[model samples]
Target: MKSGEGRVCQNPWLNQGHTVEFSPDGKRLLVGSSGFDAVFEFDTDSGEVVWEWFAWDHGFDRSKLGHYVVRSEAKCKALEAMGHEVLLVDDPGKYEFGIPTRQKPAHLNSASYDSEGRILVTLFHQGAGYVVDRKTGDAQEVISGLINPHKLSRRKRGGYFISDTRRGKLIFIDENYRRTSEIALAGTPGIERSPQLSEYLQNTTELREELFACIDIHRSSLWLIDVKRRSYRGIKFPVEWSVHDVASLGRQHGLRIRGLVGTQFGKVAAFARQLKIIHHFSVDGCEVTALVLDSQDRQRQLDV
Candidate 1:
């Protein structure tokens, strides 16, 4: 395979690709650009542009459901004095963005296609997740009240696994969208192995009370990515990746790990390391395009 030589998309707004995934049939590639509100589709083998879906083009309402009742004008003035902007909008009507037809902006973080081919997406700012039927373009809420849900993975069974970055917990929801189980980083395998690691996790209790970073579920094992520790562990796989976000290469094949660690300058450095390979690569300005494994040892690309 040619290293560092591939077809590149020259679109400026689409330059920084955040995440990518292959369709189940391996015919198309889905790309998610975090900085923008669109997901791109491309041909898998030929790297040809297919179509782009813009979230803003859809009519989905992206407002929080609730109302702030102000008992008196003095209390409202006190809130305004604290530099907090208050909007006196009610539910349902709150979704309008000053215009009659335009919908409010939703900051979409990650998205995935479910078994029925419907697209499910996570909205960070709204703390809610939605499922959009690709055939009808109708998006409906699936879950809500999540604190910074970042990565989403489909389970082999029938549900979904959501990564709550802010709360540091891996939430497993059933098909009915009810939270089934939540795994914290305190008593897991990786932290249990080292005493120092356990102490650090205990210290975080004064701050947040729980240490959950990232999580991935394989066949029968559960892998955890610890943002606080800047490490990856097969909490159930019995192996460790250098980072987190473990994407399996194939059945019995090793895993690909990606993680972020804060540097001295207070910026996060993104690192990618393969499980079998000892050396890892530091992503400069580029984020992970996609991590997919074929039946053979070769890996494919779905991002620029």
Candidate 2:
């Protein structure tokens, strides 16, 4: 074994970095910083911010994010004056990874580069999505009236898909951001139980065609929603009692789940819920293998 340490880049403005996206050419990194209520684009090589957009500059309330947005540099300078090595705090207990407890307004969770040098963003607290011009940092509200919108991704065929989390629906919108169709994960087929209304849809990724792998919190399962057919199939993952996000790793890599809680594969699963597991499933939704990570191992896994 060998020990290693290195310094890459540091930027005090990027607080609570929720979701990251890379440019198509892999030159720039787009970051959605919820704490600062801003989205930023950083050069991959130099680690310098090339473009930035602040929600408060648009229509976001300044009261919710003014502290972080205004005093970020001063706070970092104060910490530096105190001889502190790191400006940003990377504590799991402080940040509450995999939990949606932070209640900052304009909590930008996801950011991605869209066509024609425009970027897409989803603000969970604001319940809206925006399309921003990369050059001018001008934002246009594309979709609104959502409840805790998660990921807004462009479909391969056409149009776009958004995970309206609190509403437990996978919403599809056209290029103009008009609501075309939506599939309610809670009301999806195979759910015979009465509507407990516990379904919280999280990260959604296009699997193939119209099928999408959606993270449903009800049974900690993946609800494969078919957009065209308006149908769904629930793949019950009992090992992990709380699944957070799901993604298709492609036809070669299959499907991967970013789960929050997990237990052993047995009847006493309820008793053992301390483990964090990452399950790899086949494209067909069958469990391929499970890797359980204990506390001593890696503390966090990147959301795929």
Candidate 3:
């Protein structure tokens, strides 16, 4: 709530959390914890786990998943016996930095509920989408052969939309998991989105105006678009680093941008308007530190 202060709800199952969203009733928090290879629902008021769906519980084999589950107390002890560092499974930061990159099989990037009250998730490493029964935890692979898919959202009209990052395509699929259409990403040109990019600049209702924002990491630029007018304005930043994500701290505070020079060092900038830079800060390396608008509509750094 205060500067540099946050509420920490520590849970062993909340490891490497990728996507978190509130249920339609706004009482349950659904999270797709990639490291655990599972999706979970937690009670918002009590912080109690309502349900969890593990990939292995639904036909997946332990040999095919990430070893993050092994970070439990007993397993960590065994790993320490082998001269490995002991990082608790409850500490996602350790699993993120201490573990190897190969520990991902059902690398879930997004999770949401469909109209039928079923769970839909996109597995980046598996390049597939799965439909899971909310009550039974029974899952079936609905779609596959995608190139590093992310962001699964149910369409208002019908079907769903998912971002195929590696292929630079926004694929639309029917209820039966058949491809209906695909849109090639434009504006950024040859610059492709990365699976490592957890936060994305997309459409939101917070803005007072009907405008869309797109960031060009390669050029260090931001494009403000007005679809109704078919016009856009490009604002360039003074930094050479790649801007990963942006957050709006209301109209009075302007936009905040988060970027990294490389793997270790990170940077954040505040822009008032156009090309005007108001503030900048340097950050220590983390797996992913995102600029987000908090409950009071204030800017805050969230590590995921």
Candidate 4:
């Protein structure tokens, strides 16, 4: 795939549109922006905003102030112990708001589409996850107590699992809404765990246990973990300029298409992380909002 290939959702109040998901129908993209506290659907071919599904903003529901925007006080306490600021843990307005000092809206960090055509976003800093209504565009809290939720992954067996970046825990939720704490393979003995989390993904095999993850640190890297073998290896994915968000090519796809979501001004694009590059960000001059299409043809390749 070439640079500046399949790209869209270019600059329109996308301060923290860090997370992007392919539409269920594979014709659009759902971009979740923390800067705007909303998820807007963008036409893949046109790159035009179709509509937005806003996350709960400050004073969203005065009737139930803390309903949709709840946080894990315990998790916040842990992050505070980890050297995060007190105001950042409890009164999070300062994180986003600089002036009036109102509460910060739910920052939609990651997004996924359910079988019912609804978008599920990890409300990271908000300590919860919300499921958006396909028709009304409104959202309701479905998972809470998640500390700085980052990635939302659907399981092959029953339910779903989410990554808590701050706490370093992977929580599992069943179809019946039962929650259980889980440790990613990296946390186990002999397996290396990268600091500063970004995304977690498990392959859709019979066991549904092999995992893939990426670190959002300065020298960002990627990992492939085989739980059954109890072994893992790290790939030195070199990049000069920093990066923030990553989207996975489905497990079924033999092409390990991992797209880099360029924020803070750069091009959005996708490629296999295992590929080595001897180039710098200046080579492209930061053309944000372009990446490889998980095109139907590629999906067909995976299916074959």
Candidate 5:
């Protein structure tokens, strides 16, 4: 609970962390690790497991008429090696499990709470989105035909905007889980609500009351714009920490791993309201280290 310099709470159980999300209650980080083939909750304070669930173990492979079952050649071989005749398609790219993208998704990309209270998550290396029953941990695929979808945030009025970086558009999902509309995006892959941004730049007549944007997290650079006015600027991080980490990073940065940035969760203090920059790092042979740099200074390391 201290700030000034960031902190570190190592949890080795997290492997191939595809998606890192802070719980809505803001207590634990819900990590989707493809290596573990499950999404697990870890303590924000002690880095201990709260609970976890594998997608395959939780209805990810349910028999649905419109849904296609996809498995990698390696997985099919692994299952066959285990004495199961797992037939797989010759071209996995066109399958539900595999999109037209380069990387094959295996776990999840991002998560958010839907109006119905279900935990909505986009599958890794896949073209589908799913919603999970919060209390039971059960899941069901809700949307399809998206090419490597990124962070999806619930809109204030209603529905949710799904950022499809690969496809260069945002698919709008209604409260009923239907793809109602779409928004065109160019270079940015991820987007998040910026309440503090609207408050800070109150004098900007072209800006709206509630701002949304894509950030270069490592440098803490923000691209604030007036989508309608066609006016924008590339500058320093938003002069506020409240909206720092609202949009969770997807499995592959910008729809690819090569250009990814940021060290997962940049603490904004416990619930991440306010945190300071720090200066330090440590590694013990084989443990994951989560690091964060202050948005303002960029050079100063924040809590680990």
Candidate 6:
């Protein structure tokens, strides 16, 4: 095995980089810090920090706001007793991963660039997403009440797709932050659970049993990243099979799909979570341009 040599920046603030993105021209890199409520810009070739933006200093407060409270007394008591304020609880131990906590207000989960060269970023605990003007340092809200938005992908027509991990739903919101459509994840065999609700009142097991497990999406199809089953699947539109049908077929084929990426030719590349690679028959008919691995270990590609 061979390891490639890369320059390592030892800055304490950026030591635990949660996300890294390349600038439009690929001349600079944007690093999101998990340890600090800040974003850092570094010169790719020089490894020098050219700019730093702090979310906390910009009138952002995490402690004052509260997450959605489920209507159930038992769950509410449990969460309250633990001092967990987030509405979504995807993973109790990893509260940050499942939902945003008050301790990390500017905990940015995902980011993307809009068509007009603006930067869009999502804050986990804050229950809001923002679009920042590159030249003016102005920020505008995109959406709210998202159950811990995990990722955001730019759409073809100047909009964006957001993944609400705790809710197991994908919402397509336009540039103005108005939701267009939402799709839930379909459950796989042996892994049946509905998306979590903030109101404890809606936390019934039957409600949780509705699996619409899709987590990500491209322009044409939605990617079913069933974390529970550790598999990937694809959902195509226009007379495609329902989620239940796809899950049934997956059980018969012995295929557990985890991540999906649309190719240039409109096909999807499915990846198995356990395998940590693309499935044998997952190759789509599109051209491959760029490959990226997100914070959740899902693979993504950019193609025409």
Please report, in order, the local distance difference test score of every candidate based on alpha carbons: 0.47, 0.65, 0.57, 0.51, 0.49, 0.49
Write model 5 residue lDDT over 1-304, tens digit each, in one string: 2222233433443455555666666567776554434567767666677766656456453222223223456666776676754435445233322221222224455555565556667674566777778779877777777665555656656666665645545566787778887545344433333423211111011113334564433223455545446555656643223232334345543354333344333233222323343322222222234334332222234444
Candidate 1 residues lying further than 4 Å off, grouped into runs, are 1-12, 59-104, 186-244, 250-304
With candidate 5 superimposed using the best TM-score fit, by how many Å does residue 298's alpha carbon deviate from the native? 33
- Summed backbone clashes in each candidate are 1, 0, 0, 7, 11, 23
TM-scores for all candidates?
Answer: 0.51, 0.62, 0.58, 0.56, 0.50, 0.50
Q: List the residue pairs that clash in candidate 4.
A: 266-287, 266-288, 267-287, 267-288, 268-289, 268-290, 269-291
Clashes of 3: 0
The per-residue C-alpha lDDT of model 4 at residue 207 equals: 28
* Descending-TM-score candidate ranking: 2, 3, 4, 1, 5, 6
Model 3, range 145-264, lDDT digits (tens) per residue?
Answer: 877677566765667767665554556679888898764444354333353643333211112253445544433456665545767676776443444334345533332112212244
User: Which numbered prediction scores highest in TM-score against the true structure?
Assistant: 2
For model 6, the stretches where C-alpha displacement exceeds 4 angstroms are 1-5, 64-102, 186-304
Q: How much does each candidate deviate from the true structure in C-alpha RMSD?
A: 15.5, 9.8, 11.1, 14.0, 14.6, 16.2
lDDT of 2 by residue, 200-303 (tens): 78778887888889877654677776767977677876533444445445533332222321323212121124556666555445666655544533344434
C-alpha RMSD in Å of predicted model 3 compared with the true structure: 11.1
Top-scoring candidate (lDDT): 2
Please give the RMSD of candidate 6 to the true structure: 16.2
Q: Which of the two candidates, 1 or 4, achieves a greater lDDT against the reference?
A: 4
Model 4: number of backbone collisions: 7
Compared with the true structure, the alpha-carbon lDDT of candidate 6 equals: 0.49
lDDT of 6 by residue, 219-289 (tens): 12345443335555654542111111122234423332222212223222333433223322223423444
Candidate 3: clashing pairs of residues: none
Better candidate by TM-score, 2 or 5: 2
Q: What is the model-wide C-alpha lDDT for candidate 2?
A: 0.65
